[model samples]
Target chain A: MSIDNPETMETPTGEALAEAPILTEVLPELPTVMDEQDLIIETRNLSKRYGRLQAISNLNLQVPRGAIYGFVGPNGAGKTSTMRILTTLMKPSGGEAYINGYSVVTAPREVRRSIGYMPDFFGVYEDMKVWEYLDFFAACYEIPEAQRPGLINDLLELVDLAHRRDDMVDKLSRGMKQRLCLARTLAHDPQVLILDEPASGLDPRARIEIRELLIELAKMGKTIFFSSHILADVNEICTHIGIIEAGQMVAQGPIKAMRQQLMPHRVLVITLLGRLDEAKEALLHVEGILGIVDLPPEDGKIRIKVEFTGEDLRMSEMLQALTSKGIPVVNFAEESSDLEAVFMKATKGIVS
Target chain B: METPATRTRISLNPLRPLLRNPVALKELRGRMRGPRAFVVLTCYLIVVGGFTTLLYIAGTAATYNTTGEVDGGTLGRVLFGSVVAIELFLVTFITPAFTAGSISGEHESQTYDLLRTTLLPERQLVFGKLFSALAYVFLLLLAAIPLQSIAFLFGGVDVEEIVISLLVLLATAIFLGNIGVYYSAMTHRTLRANIMTYVTILAVILVTTAGAVIALAIVEGLDPSTSSSGSEWVLLVARGIFVCLNPLTTLLSTQQYLVNQQTLFTFKYTFTDGTTTTLPSPWIAFTIFYLLLSVVVFFATTRHLKRIEG
Candidate 1:
């Protein structure tokens, strides 16, 4: 197969490995993009096409180490497909991908060692108890026999399924099963965790629990790359985010940067003890107040939603100006960056 | 994360993965934990054991010894053949049933990808599934030994004959079981994999037997006056190979040769020109062919899995 990077030239495959014999010579060093050595996962112009349908097209994604990178996209926008390629479960039709320093196509074994993948839909072996299930996977990774018991126990405790360690995997609830699967991905203690729609189909409590688990894992210094169509899940836990639409990344960077790029103005919700029109009238003269809309009053207090392009100092000055007019402001808070706005606006016309 | 030293295993021990395969271990645990394995084993033993008792009773009452004395050796041979035939039939079908779902079931349950991502390697996955599936069948084979040893009480079937029979039975189990694994690797649905495996094995048996029969009929119909050197001899060798291809025919023909004591390892064919040649006996030929075939199937399945993993 031909690759865009002429330096690597030929992709090392089974036949290539046989012909070359020496692995080091056959597998050329994959050039890191823009000298970002911290990128745990990188895909350059990676594309996959099934017949005439292109699942992914010229996709470039870079997830740095120890960053909770949220890959948000509409359905069928190549989230799972890209994750599969990175996990070495599928070959890209074109271009190349790397996990750490290992080329995914040429060095799949290394890539598999570096990353733990949890797919969108997964099932457990019904006959296996929770501990046995973990042990089985641990053995798959060729973990030493003596260490498996300790590792399984540690993993079970981490997922909070330690109390149910002896129960059959089939008996666990959907939420519990998801947690167990997340634990299964950790059987090898991989450097990167690629989870696809981890919180989908979970109840609110379970979703929150999963969110907390991810946060905890991130705090442990793992490079977590997860995909979600649920924007709230992305907005909650992701430090950096990539928004994909129509099989291409439209926006990607730190979550704050992407949010700012998607939304040019901040949303300020102000609650007043006095009249609403008076606050609106005072806000019309404030600097950086692009527009104002009166909101539904809560608890006998008038509320107004303000669209402002400003900093913290500008917001403070505006609040001071409103109270100076005897507007009696009860609350003035700027809305946090809502990834829903980024997801909706970025993936606007793509029909999944 | 695991320490850097233990992250990757660099060993030359080829059997290391197979020695302790998680797939096989997990499969054995799954198979034995349920009542399904026990139920199947019970049914298999009943069929083989039940057949032996019925055959023993019938052989006892038969009038082969017209002098009113029982022919113990003849009765023993009859019982041995009866029991083995039933065991072979059950093993042929039962072996594949255990293996046919091995890989495909993983796909159906959505665990195939999870299993593949690990460092388990493809060959281990294939053989692990094969061993775990055939382990129970092998157990059934071993369990039937007592019923087969009934021949020893009557003093006809020797240990050599018993060994050859078990060898053929083991070969048959492995061949059919590997075929199931082959189809399992090729397909996503277990039911379809099973159907394909059964069809392929049935075709092997029917085509070989029918081909041998039809070739014999055509050769017999040819003019007796004509003298064709090497033609008839080649046909004899061809017929022997064909018979050996079918496990049932191989068992019967090998047993027949052992009873005749004409040859142990080979059959000598005399041509019209008074030249003679020897061909390997049915059991030897059958065992060697199936052993090589099983190896090929194992490698083919591994290669297919590697491709699919991509």
Candidate 2:
């Protein structure tokens, strides 16, 4: 019932489209919006070079205040290096990064206080129990002794591990350990979270749980910078995605905007009940239809490439001619671009 | 509405949690929970207590024929002397076992980053561990005090001497403790740290002893009465440098106590021949040198720990 509860954040409204159009009618919050600045994280020509090897080169990123940005790249693509530089764990060899307008190098303590960074491969102190582990981190973050117990309890429950509060960290499953790690990162109540492969080695259920938790955090106006190899997860939850290849950002933008920019053309797949030679010959006379690539010899389906020049093109013209000849047009579908296709097209198939 | 009071409470230094306690209660508790610590402490007590009791009985029986009595200070000189020697022997073995595992053990367990990324500074880490090890040694020393106090039951035992001796032992243990910590910080594996620290300590002790022995021999062989005053002065200089080599300086800060009572520094030196010229007091110098060495080792370990990127 309450917005503060995570369940409320998860329940998406089907009537959201109708609700969104009403907000733009009055322009009620324009003056207030301009007062708040953008760019929680910004990098200016940030470069890291190990002798001749450049791990990350000229990385300039602007993560807005409340964006769940996915940083996707293959192994050794410098995602970890960039996270380290932003978190103040490692200094950039060339340029600098800012966290909430504070330079990471010059104001490291402020930057550290503002961001919670979780590296990909981290170990939990097995000797400590779950609560004790969180307690230690809370102490590390300099949380007041009186306030820590309540905060720790709240975080454990948030991660759905409150029942395992007294359990030894080593005994918990890998997923529980990861959730605890996230909870530990939030011990200081940091504004920004830079998670390097937060779901790197989780089971399917655990992966979904992490994804849900991240989406919940994003709704609470937190800036989450996460890197993952799972494109499906990125597609499902990320508001924006940046693809890095060989220390370079190949493509980055809102998913919808990127799809619109990259894919101006549409594909129409049609399956006819009766195959007639007249339907195949009529494909050339259509306007703005680039070319038709036929299905294999075994299948009687044909894929039509529709390039609409000025107005929306019609599949009805071909359907009308085919049906008028007593050939039924059984299946007509539009092929939409998903994140996988966008990633493939953007990277140009060169992962390294 | 109530009016607010105009009082402000300010904390002068807010980062005090990072200072954390140096006593290493966590380390002591862990060590106490294990059987190894108890066994070590037990063995140390038995050896030191048994040795003092045996010496007290022997010295009392041997002096029975004399009318003059053997007093507590004389008994303590013999008993505490052996206790210090055996402690040094145990320390050589035990200090390495505890400290050689510090950094390298963390590296082995892969929990190093857990501590390193925290607000705790590296010097605090080094000294925290060093003081913890020293506390264990101090506990063992306290256990021997009752046995040592047995000598006070007799006459002539000086409490100030006993106190000074314990202080010297604590300082020396701290110095050697840092040596093991420095080695542990330098290596990635505990086994290598253990081996290297043992070898290095052994080498330094042996080389210094050998050099001291040679200098003493040369001084003894020369006849100071027939030699020139310059040769006599050279002998004094050699003997003075020899004081630096003796680990016994660790026990007795004063120069006179470090040099053997039997060995003579030839008295035929200046115009005032036969008037003994005392060597300069080495307490201040040795304390400064060893403390400086400990500081350097702590700084080096901190530097090494700070450079760990991952």
Candidate 3:
């Protein structure tokens, strides 16, 4: 956890240095006040245009440090464009983007040093072995040659590709390749990771593995800002979610807060074994119940759907009230809110 | 658990990192790893060697009986000239093949974005590609040294001749390599870049030579007298400027200087008032012109890359 030594010169011959422990002294520590900062990646009125077509318009994003900010958008929704600007790979035509307090346009090298970018479609050097590929990138990042061997081994372990260290990159499976790419992004140990559709072409299992790996990276104090069209993957892993559509951000906030804001009412389903009439009468007496719809019985149990306007504690109290009155409540559950539903409510499917 | 072979392969070679160019190292390693590199190298040597042997046989046969003695110096000059000319031609084609795809290949493979996002600057990327391609071309030129050495034994070609020939060849490779890198940065498709690079090289070689020839013909017609005139001097100076930019002219000029101890185009020009002067050697002018032109093209390529990525 020491600062990078500017005086640590690399020998002209690219000789390897003495072996050291993998992670402890290798990577520079995260900035002390990074967590206290309001945003690790921020953009104000960011815009891009290709002649007449606007790729991204008025994009204002604030991604807090140490959070997995999922950028959710449909295809061609300017998600990739926004990520490109933030990664310093492209210029924003109208506005500005800052990474770790450095302007992407004004101080691009600093921005590059602060962020690891994984584009949506990237090519690996098929001729290179996994370890050699990592070593090459580490060299590009100016990591001391002596430090690369241990760093490569550590990254391979992190992405679960330790067994494929010497395997040709082209020989890896799609999932393994995706994981290897993720590992490559971590080679320089940047504080922020900007991944564009990291799981786009992955199978379900591969997607899950990438998701888990991203969660682990976030746990390691890295700010993960990734873009995806897959709402399920985003929902499962992202602590904060931003939904963009048609080159504009529709909504962005914490997942729970977003769900609550988009969906104000909850649907409660109650099942009764024998006291069907008793449960119906008792449910109508609850104060927060707006309406109740009786459903056809299945498996000899009565079902009722109640439109309830209450928080978790009030819902629990209502559940307790039913069981106290000899209603024989077999099951009482509230329907869970999902990202797909939230996305559907948030965007009008417009694209410019 | 390190094997001796692995240890040797991974050993720190100080010269390896001196350039501090990861792109060049990656490219050189990849270029040398495949059997194709060996195949190309072998073919190049065989062709150059086969051609030199044929020239020697022809020259020896032509002059063997007429004088009852073989003139080794004349025979050496013929062999040296032919071999150097062939190397120049081979390099013109070979350099573009190595460089035309350097940048565009990354784009084609979808790796350009990944590379651009790194801390590597655009200049390094451009120069890394140029150096790697030139390095391979230099290797090809190096392989022909033994064939050129045969000229020395024959006694007609001196070390200066061989050195000047290699310098011209190297300069030509560098100039052509810069063209390839330029087009590679301008275009995203490898095929397109390759075609454009070759076209530019052809245009340079053909147009410059043809233009100089036509201009010299007109200038020669202006004054048929053997005596040097002011107008003829002006034309000679103009022709020197034109021919120096062409690699063929530059190579021939260097040979003229080395073999005859004379400039490529020497014309005594008298001013209207009778003061006279001789034009500088085209070889010196060519060397300076090409080196400066290469720098300009390199900066252009670097600027194009920066603009495109932005």
Candidate 4:
């Protein structure tokens, strides 16, 4: 896939991610390297106040081009407000934001051209067929009449809604409507997609479908800035993640960098078939063991969480030492290297 | 329902932007498609046509005598008046309904945000909404022309009367149309917009009529023994403002003034003392006043939409 300006240059006009060839791109190509020139979305001390309530406060964000950036936080964390501000649907009370070098406040029209925004709620036009809905939005984005039909076909094909093109928009299932809404966003052939809770109310199957579609778009080199309270969705889909809490950004970078920064060591949870004191004494003096804490015992087995600052080889050696001391190591599972730790920190309001 | 008519290649004929504006095109398509538009047009024609036919039969039979003497001109004028009244009633009632929801309905459905985020300009959005919404009312008015022209066969209704009535009906639609758009922009809900549009219309009718009646009473209270140009001018100004605000008043008053005084667009009002004060005809006043009102309202709606985007 080609990476154009994705901002100042012309829109893709008609390109589907599924049909585009996937390049073997790795972490360096993804965002969180934090180069200023490649940043497609940026904010400087952006703040919004609704009457006396501060919906967003001092929000500084940086999202690079061609990155699927997940904005994760708990409910009422100002995700929607920030998305609304970036989409130019609402004005920011203070500070500034830019999309593709266009000021969100001053050059909103230009910003709008660069970004395709889908709000959390599914808002479809009543009495309109699915194709007509896409057609209407395509015309709205000022796509030429000559290219609208083919463009509509490409968009529907991309979102997997071609079969339901003739169905009434309101008559479709909720998941179908969401896919249609996502398809509508692509009608403009925008470079960046800013989705607010794209899979907020979808069933598990539908959520996975949306997640796969988003990953395909990312592979095709379109930057996606999506907000969700669900950490699991962000963890699975985002190449880069920004954790926000109470309208403030807690942490943002490539997911790997975030994991290393938050927990600069490997965490292993081991379950033992014994009483707690014997296993604890055996692993306490072992080399490469940073700390150990007893978790709730399961089925008369002792469970201990081990924080280790060591290599993969050392983890095996430490396990060997435990068994040599006549200690039973039934389960020695490595903890997932995901966003859960960072999200927990965000939720606890400790990142500030 | 799919209306593929709008799917055709857009033309470059500078006069046809409405066809290009997606909002207007979508609105026009949705309005005209399905059985709804046909049902409305059918119901309207049947009522007007049926009423005209029944009135003609009843009036002709009532005026018949042994010598077959009947004032067909009187019957014709009565038919014209009744037709105008019914059309006015139907139009005034339904014009606001079409536009009252045009903007706020988008808000209720949450599509307004999606629309504003598009590259489409705000003024174009307002224009598209207003133009398509009023298009149906205009279609209704034009369709009734045949029924209105039926009175010409009997005699007293002139081409001028028909033309003037049509103009007044159009101006009335524009007036109510703007009111609906104005309230639709100001309010967030269609029900509130509908109520406000009707309230504004009712208030204008009641206030103007009351103003006219009071001015007439003051003119009557003055001693006719004196040449009070002030009372005459007061009566004329109040009448002008009244006709300007109220379409029914403007139509009927202009017809009477034309028939009795033969004054067309503008003429002088002669004082009892050989002096004259020139004044515009009632329909002219109505046209100018409501059109200016519509322009003001158009700006108000535009400004509101701008603020919404900001």
- Backbone clashes under 3 angstroms, per model: 0, 3, 5, 0
Residue B197 of model 2: what lDDT?
86
Poorly placed runs, candidate 3 (over 4 Å): A1-37, A271-281, A293-304, A311-331, B1-14, B17-19, B219-228, B261-276, B308-310
Q: Write the per-residue lDDT of candidate 1 for residues A1-352, one digit (tens) a residue.
A: 2222222233334564354334332322221223335788888999999888888999999887788888988788889999999888999999889998899999989988988889999889988898889888988998988788789889989989989988999999999999999999999889999999998887555665687788778777678899998776676567889988878988888777788888989998988888777677777777888888878889988888888886888798888888788878778898765676666777776756
Most DockQ-accurate candidate: 4
Docking class of 3: acceptable
Q: What is candidate 4's lDDT per residue for A102-207, written digit by digit as tens? A: 9998888899999998898747888788888988999899998778878888888998988888888889988888888888888887899999999888755566
Per-candidate fnat, comma-separated: 0.70, 0.14, 0.56, 0.58
- Candidate 4 per-residue C-alpha lDDT over B148-229 given as tens digits, one digit per residue, 9 for 90 to 100: 8888888878898888898888888888988898899889799999999999888988998787777666765666578477
Query: Residue A133: error of model 1 in Å?
Result: 1.0
Q: Which residue pairs come into collision in candidate 4?
A: none
Evaluate residue A112 in candidate 3 and report its C-alpha lDDT on the 0 to 100 scale.
Answer: 90
CA RMSD per model (angstroms):
11.5, 8.4, 9.1, 6.9
How much lDDT does candidate 3 score?
0.81
Q: List the candidate 1 regions with Cα displacement exceeding 4 Å.
A: A1-37, A269-285, A291-306, A326-333, B1-19, B218-224, B270-276, B308-310
lDDT of 1 at B19: 47
> Which candidate's lDDT is highest?
1
> How much native contact recovery, as a fraction, does model 1 achieve?
0.70
The Cα RMSD of model 2 versus the native structure comes to 8.4
